[model samples]
Target: MLDDFDRVLAQARRGSPEAFQSLHGDLVRPVAAYLRNKGVTEIEDVTSDVFLAVFTGLGGFTGGQAAFRSWVFTIAHHRIADHWRREARAPALVELTLDDDGGTTPAAEHHALDALGTARVHELLDTLTPDQREVLLLRIVADLTLEQTAEVLGKPAGAVKSLQHRGLAALRKIVEPEGVSP
Candidate 1:
């Protein structure tokens, strides 16, 4: 399946419409999900921007599939950075209170509790700087190796390891304040 993507990307670089369509179909959902996970509310808009940038920059790719994926994500990272810069002047987000309305009884409370736990994980991730988050996601979620993550972020492997270590430590502080000694 990925081999097909490589072929499509090559064709896309030559301005092939069919290849572009194939690539869009392959990537749109994952890209949107990635953006949403990164706290981009207008995921569709940003996803479109990422693809547009990918299509425009396809000619610049000098490596294979891994490199291409990294290139696409690098574009995504830049777009996310731009979004943050534009919104930097805006007010910060205030954490919301979760009150159980009578509609959600004890049974529903369990589900809500689970959701709250998951939300806490995401909230913790939100605390990291973008570079740290990017390296963390690429290493953990995307299951890329440290070397691959470094290549994607255009950073050294040692730097990627340092960021990952710091990011995980921060996540541990949020997820397990009792300490990881156990």
Candidate 2:
């Protein structure tokens, strides 16, 4: 994908429908998942909105794939913040997942939680501050590099690093208390 990214991006910039489709196809899932992890309620709608912004702004966007990814997430981050601001409330802590029926099911949700330990994961994540949580999400769930996470957060890389470190330490303490290790 990276090998053809430049060509595709250039074509997309020049108004190529195929190129735009390719870019959207490549990015949509991860972007959606990232937004979901960030607790965006309107995942599909917000994901579309993010890509719309990306495509509209692609003409002036100048960078390789890494930068492009960071740029996309930067937009997503802003959108999530905007959503929360408009609602004027904290995001819901629940991580909603759909079953094969295209709706949430108790059995399927239980299986999923057991398989991924998602309930425990969410509980642990809830212990961190919002900034620490966002840093971890961008770095781990979004599979972004330190620099990319920093770019998304508009912070110095060192600040991101510190957040990640502290966040991990907090989790570690909770998971392995009193110097006891599993």
lDDT for each residue of candidate 1 in 77-128, tens digit (9 for 90 to 100): 7888877776787787887867855564569789999889769768877899
Runs in model 2 deviating more than 4 A are 89-116, 177-182
Q: What are the models' TM-scores?
A: 0.69, 0.80
lDDT of candidate 2 over 38-109, digit per residue (tens)? 777789989998999999999889889999999998998888878778667665577676556566546876
Report how far residue 6 has shifted in candidate 1, in Å. 3.7
The C-alpha lDDT values of all candidates are 0.78, 0.87
* Stretches > 4 Å off in candidate 1: 88-118, 126-131, 169-182
Instruction: Give, for candidate 1, the lowest lDDT window spanning 10 residues.
Output: 173-182
How many steric clashes between backbone atoms does each model show? 0, 0
- TM for candidate 1 is 0.69
Worst 10 residues of 2 by lDDT: 97-106
